[model samples]
Target: MTHEITDELQGIKVLVTGGAGFIGSNLCEFLLNNNAIVHCLDNFATGHRENISSFLNHPNFTLFTGDIRNLTDCKNAVSSMDYVLHQAALGSVPRSINDPITTNEVNVSGFLNMLTATRDEGVKRFVYAASSSTYGDSTTLPKEEDIIGKPLSPYAITKYVNELYANIFHKVYGVDTIGLRYFNVFGRKQDPNGAYAAVIPKFVKQLIDHQSPVINGDGSFSRDFTYIDNVIEMNVKAMLSIHPDAANNVYNVAYGERTTLIELLGILKEELAQYDTAIKDIEIQFGPERVGDVPHSLASIDKAKSLLGYAPVFDIKKGLQASVDWYWEHLK
Candidate 1:
């Protein structure tokens, strides 16, 4: 999993805010593998300890039990870090809808705390996990960075606000920031049991249990499903990018392709059937379309490609196969 971009991380002090969660833990692992000094800050709200248990004893790895909402906690974790990967936001549109107040407290106020800490600490670069949900109701294909419609959910509004805060932080405080808008990332260690679990892992868990996975609509809704590896690569690139115009810019982190739910289910079943033949016979159930879900999603990765030299090594099929193998081996 080592890439040329990771070479810049050798000996660098990096802090991952939600290092016990899926994407955050993966980033911590990648940083450690590349010989970076990794410090993780997490409170275990939505994160699991087992995700980072294997790295707890690593010489360069340190874990700090803290929440992002606390300014002192953020400052303490970021004290000596050279780079900050801010991933400690409350995710899920449904969760935000159910509890918009908490979502705002964490995603907005907490993000401000982290950004302020990064600036005060003089971190060289701040890279945070922005979301594709920020695209909102924009009916454009191959979504470009600059154009976005009104946010359709509290979660989306929070993410969009993050971009605004990052831009303002750079202009006002002179903090170097890069925002990577991830598109439906899925991979190993992604929790499959939660109510807000991502579609790929949720459906994989259902199929593994011989339970019919339900589609939210007629299965026509599509998404630009990004792999965790691709996301890690982009994060590294953003952290290390020296392009004169790269700072304070947000880039789309995706494979630049889309797959509908029906098509996704078909591929998932085929991939799982290799281990369990019975999975192929399991049917899909259709339900009402989820509110706040866009009809389609696709990304124009040209900005990242040109500025950060991002080249995604895994497409949806390859990513799904890898995810299915992990889920079968670990969950089954």
Candidate 2:
């Protein structure tokens, strides 16, 4: 099994906030696949309803169409769950730059609601989604867990604030918290046509539709570009394990490898050219660098590997190929 959910999490009660988005939906599927009674809460602000439509009928699954920014909603959702996976938040650097207030409301205030709810509810473990953008201006090559710079965007500030709040909960309320700093995760069921869609799916969609995919900057900036399976592993490990030293810590969930934009476009073209050879001829356009964008990002997974026993399964090429195949089948 490419993503066999371990029995450690089986039979556990889980509340996955933002359960309709790319990573949240995948986590919901993995939990159900492993026999956990799962509850999903989403407001459909950035997440799509169609993403979890297939799981609506599962006996072990409960879908609550709600927002995390509301304390009552987060409190009601967290009351019965043994573990909480907080994945909901507004994403995208430019979107956050344009609308920092909404981003703050959703990502910052919304995170605090979840934190307060989970702590008060006496949940066994709380694992939330953090972002690599927390490494705002460090100029470091492969980001480590302990060392971090200031935030670059409003979105980044929200994610960094997640860590801060989690730490406070752990210290003040004795709520066990863990943060997975995800770096460029992409795979199946990702929304391709959204205003804030991620790069892999967005690029693949344009390439398939015979549209030029715009590369911001000179196409030389790079990222770790982790896959969904690896991210799922990190979450499961963080939730299921009972390591004394690992609690109240943050770890980067990413492939330890780096790939440039030009290399990524080449790979996307190579994969998509199989179905539509004309994709090979689709010219890639360049644009000036966007605000609040990092020039490069890579992760050092030693912390995750040693502590939570985290092991990532796919690299950029394999992950992008899987993404391309999935989008081709589902987006048609």
Candidate 3:
């Protein structure tokens, strides 16, 4: 899945905020594999030390134990970096709903701190993890970049604010930026034990443990579940994009397809069944719908394709199989 811009990443200094979390850790690994000098900044508020332990001793990797809320830490992390992959944010709508103040402090105020620090450091470009939740109350299928609705949760509000801040930073200070509105991303290293754990990993863990997984609704809710490799490709492309029109823009990073929750669970069960046939018999429980959850989500990746020559190589099934294999080895 290496892009044509692979040569540009070699020996480049890259900072990955939240570099100990799922997506962040994966980004760090990809960048390091491509011979980038990787600096990972994390406070471990949500990220796990074990997630990054394997790479701590890597010659090309440096770990910065710091919180994004502190301007000093943000400044320290951004200093002397060729690019900033800002993935540090308090995710999950329910988590935000439970503690909007903390979410705002980290996702909004912390984001501002990173922006200022990156601007001050004279980084080449700032590529960040945005969210499909930014689509908010919009009912449109295959969500386009230009059309968005009111944010239904504090988390969404913070992500939307990030886009605003990035735009202003680019316009006011000439700091190049790109925001990737990630769809429901799932893959290896995604935490499966947290209250805010995503569906794929959470259910995989439950099924592995022989526990019946619970669904929030009737299991018809769908999302454009994106894989980690696809996301890494987008980050790389965004960092290397030389097109005049690509800078300071937001693009949907997804596979351009959707899957219902029931179908998702079926796939998970089937995949896990390959390891333990009993997984096929596990029943699923239903719960009340979660607050701030959208009924369905799909993204249009055309903007990324046109602007950055992005082509996602993994769909849900392939990604799920890879994830299942990783969990089978790691979870045991």
Q: Identify the candidate with maximal TM-score.
A: 1
Position 260, candidate 2: lDDT:
95
lDDT of 3 at 323: 94
User: Which consecutive 10 residues in model 3 have the weakest lDDT in total?
Assistant: 1-10
For residues 167-200, could you state the per-residue lDDT of candidate 2 as single tens digits?
9989999999999999999999888887788888
Q: What is the lDDT of candidate 2?
A: 0.91
- Error in Å for residue 269 of model 3: 0.6
For each candidate in the order shown, give its overall lDDT on alpha carbons. Answer: 0.94, 0.91, 0.94
Residue-level lDDT of model 3, residues 168-243, one tens digit each, is: 9999999999999999998999989888898888999999999999999999999999998899999999998899
| Local distance difference test, candidate 1 | 0.94
lDDT tens per residue, model 1, 29-93: 99998899999999999999999999999999999999999999999999999999999989999
